[model samples]
Structure formats: C-alpha cells, structure tokens
Target: MDVSWAAFVGVVVLAYLIPGPDFVVILRSATRGWRTGVAAALGAQTGLCVHVALAVGGLSLVLSRHPDLLTAIRTAGGLYLLYLAGRLVLATFRSAPGPDREEPAPGHGDRSAFGQALFTNLLNPKAVLFFAAVLPEFVGGPAPTWAQVSILGALDVLLGLVAWSVVILAGARLGRLLSRDRVRRWWDRTTGATLGVLGGGLLLARD
Candidate 1:
C-alpha cells in the first residue's frame, strides 16, 4: 500500500473534528450504553464504507465534472440534518418527566447493538452524502481505487472508534449520576442545537 501517511493523518484528524451523523448517533448511543454506543458507531462506519466505495467507484468523477450535482447532494444532506435535529428537539419537549422514564435497553449483546447501530447509519442520508463528498477528495482516481478506498475507509473507522469511545465512556458516567427526565430533555435539546449548527455550517460550505 503506497498510501501517504501525512495525507491519511490529515484526513483522520479533519474527519474527527467535523460534525456528522456518526458523531450524533454515537453520542446518542453512549448515553444509552456501551453496547448500543459501539453498535451505532460500527454501523455508521460501515455505512460510511459504502459511501467511500461509491465515491471512488466512479461517482466521484461525475461529481467532479458536475459540481452542481455535488452541491445539490450537499443541499439535500443539509436538509436531512435539519430534519434529524428537529426530531430530537421535538422528542425533548414531548418526553414525560419522571425517574421511570428511561431509555429503552439496546438489547442483549454485541450483535443486537451492532444491528441497531448499522440500521441508524444506513438510514441516515446525510451520513452517506457527507462521506461521498469528503472521501472523494482523498481518493481522486480510478487506479487501484478499491484498495485506496479500503485504506481510507479503515482509517476513518479507526479514528471514529477512538473518538466515539471517549464520548461513550464520558456519557455513560454522566448518565448514571443524572438519570432524570429533565436532564435527558436538556441533553436532547443540546444535541438538537449541535445538529442544527452542523447542518447550517454544512449548508454554507463551498465547493
């Protein structure tokens, strides 16, 4: 693998700093549990692989030729982010206040957790399109594209896992102490606001 280590590091670092569906989903999972948190992270990363593959497979070439199309995709992604944020905000207000109100258990073990995580990632259009745009910049050719895509994809997953793990651990600790509806609602509102900001920023991004 003749990959550029510096380029790889830059990509990983930039990706970790950027706000995306994976970040939100992982944060959501962490507050729930390690099982669900890990599941959602892996699932979301797997979906990201699909996006990278599609981008490197030839779709990126088309996008490069037609920046307008890429812009359109990004616009749609921004809309999706707004929708997700809106849902979270709505959930915050509608949730009943009580100690009995708890997040549903994520299920038995790693398998269930992984499935839930995967489903959430695959369902998020913003995640898919975000990867489509970003990964292509790193992998800009058709030569040995699959191998290149795999390398970048691996780095992305690794970095995401590292970042998400920290979030999950912190969230789990905090969640244990403050297991109340009011706190949960506040968290939801904060998450919603974060999502909204990310969406707005992405919308303002230039080609």
Candidate 2:
C-alpha cells in the first residue's frame, strides 16, 4: 500500500492517549450505565463521520482559505459546549437522588446521551482542522486525495471506537463508585466546569 500510514498511525495513537470532550461524555454516560456509554460512543463516532466527509470533500481547504467560516463554526461549537455545561451545572441544583439511584437500564436516556455526544463532537471545528491540515501531509500515495483521505480518516474513526470501548469498560467498573448521589453531584460539577473552560478557550483562541 502506497499510503504512508506509519506516521498517521502514530498520530492516531497519540490522540487516543489524550482526553477530550468525547472522553468526558463516555465516562459520564458510563456512570449512568455501560450501555449508555456505548451509545454515547456511537453518537460521537457518527459525528466524526461528518468531519471526515468534509475533509474528504475538500471543504476543509475551503474553510482554511476563509478563516471567517472556521471562526463561525468554532464559535457555534463553543457556544454549544457552553450550553451543555450550563445544563449540567443546573442539573446539580435539582433535588438530589436517593443514596444510590439504581443504575439506569439500557433504554433509559441512552438516546439523549447519544444525541448530546453526537453534537458535541460534530460541532467542534478543531476536528475538521486536524483532518484538513494533518491528514493531507500523510497522504503521499499516488491514489486520489479523496480516496486516500477517506481511508485514512476511516482508520482514525475506527481506532476512536476501539478506544472509547476500552474507556467504557473501565468506566463501567468505576461507575459503581460514582453512583453515590454526593459523588455524582461533584462529578457533574467538575465536568461542567471543565467544559465551560474548554468552550471559553475555544472562543478566545486566535486562529
């Protein structure tokens, strides 16, 4: 295969090592149930498909040429993150759960988790930027750029799914400890605050 995938694999592995919004969503959902966490992972990866499609279609290059477009996207994504954070924070104020609320069954709130995870990943401009800027450098094969990017981007998403599954497995084990009302309250608060910070950083960051 002419695809220079060694460096690309290295990048993907490094990315898996780092934590991002997806990580927070999966682990949080797992606190509800491992099944919920799996749904969240699916939604997140589906959102990743949009970014990959954009990169494969060369829309990323267009966005790069027009910084304003990217800025607009980044702003929207940041605002969305802020909105999710606000909701999480407000939820903390609600009447507390019993000592250990039974871990939710598979169907309960799984759809909601998936929806939230999908949008969280879909709206982030940084993802497309990575696909546009970093992905191209790794495309050295004589094949069409679109073809190469499709394969490379697909690999990234596949690896992401595997990584999230591993996280979900670990988080399911931790979910037992986190199920206590007091701990969950604090956990939600911390995740909310972190999301707020990330959103603010995105909005303030210069191109």
Candidate 3:
C-alpha cells in the first residue's frame, strides 16, 4: 500500500504521450478505420502485458543484466522497423492511384494491424528497460515486490490504452482528408520515414 501512485501515473502518462512506433501505428491505422486503431491499441497493451509479466516474474532484471541479449533484441527490433518503413515507402511508389476510399470493412486486415502493433511494442528496448529500471523505483514499504510491480504495470497499461484510444479518435477525425490517395500516400511516407529514423537511432544508441 506504500506505492507512489501519483508519481507512477505521472511517469506512465508521460511515457505513453511520447511519440513512438506504437503511436504512429495506431494513428496511421485509425485513418483507415476505428477497427484497425482499436486492434492496434489492444495489441500494444498485450505486448505491455508481456513486459508486465517479465517485470513481475523478475525476468526483466535478468535481461538487464545480460547486455548482449538486450543488444540482440534491440538490433532485431531496429531491423524490423526498417523493414516496415521500407515496405511503406515502396508501396507508396508501386501502387497505382485510386479514388478516395471509405473506412475499411470491419475485420478486414485487423489481424495484420494487431500483429504489427504487437511486435512494434514487444520488440521495444525502451519497454524492456523501463520495466527493468523504472518500474522498480515505485516499489516501497513491506509489500511483496511482485505485487507492487504488478500493480504498477497494470496502471501503466491502463493509462497507455486510454491515451492511445484518445489518439485513435483524433486520428479518425482526420480520416476524411487522409482518405484521399495522394494525402494517404504522403502520410505513409512520412510515418515510414519516421520509423526509419527511430530504427536508425535505436541501432546507433549507446547502452
């Protein structure tokens, strides 16, 4: 019961608010439809669940101790992001033009959206480091360490889901404009470029 609830929420909220691959994926997918956006949000939280499990079970600590494993994961994530970026950029150039489109049919491509979001988050070194490093800072008093970590992780996931839901709604509002082929293409290119930069940074970042 000695948890720093206020500080925990504040930090988690700030983390979610930062622009990252998860945010970009949800925002971009929202432009197509609400289903995609929601799926992506769910996917991201699911990945967060994995992180929470790791933190609660103390595996995250193990990962932090093994620098090589962390580096491997980081490299893989960076490569994956670059792959996604290249796909988006190439598709923009290769696809033929089309008229403005309606929201995609329900369930159509939702699986892909979800999977993309899942890895976008699951492979994130930041998430791994956050769990190993930050989540422990809020633990205090006589409570069990796992219990405290579980509570903090749950709060993080809840706040993140809510924040992303709001972002999805906002992006959906802009769908009308983005539905235009030229605009959507440009948007994809922009996100693709962003992912590319993030990937490169992650690859180049120091421990």
In candidate 3, stretches whose alpha carbon ends up further than 4 angstroms from where it belongs are 98-108
Using all chains and alpha carbons, the TM-scores for the candidates as numbered come to: 0.73, 0.91, 0.93
Off by over 4 Å in 1: 98-143, 204-206
Error of 3 at 66 (Å): 1.3
lDDT of 2 by residue, 28-72 (tens): 887778899999999999999988898888976697689798888
lDDT of 1 by residue, 60-143 (tens): 567567768767766666676677678778776663745555542223245654654565455444555556566655665556
* Candidate number with the higher lDDT (1 or 3): 3
- State residue 80's C-alpha deviation in candidate 2, in Å: 1.0
Clashing pairs in 1: 40-117
Query: How many backbone clashes does every candidate have?
Result: 1, 0, 0
Residue-level error in angstroms, candidate 1, position 23: 1.8
lDDT of each: 0.66, 0.82, 0.83
lDDT of 2: 0.82
Tens-place lDDT per residue, model 3, 26-143, is 8877877888889888998999999999988886669757869888878988998898888877777765554564422222267878988899899899998899888888888898
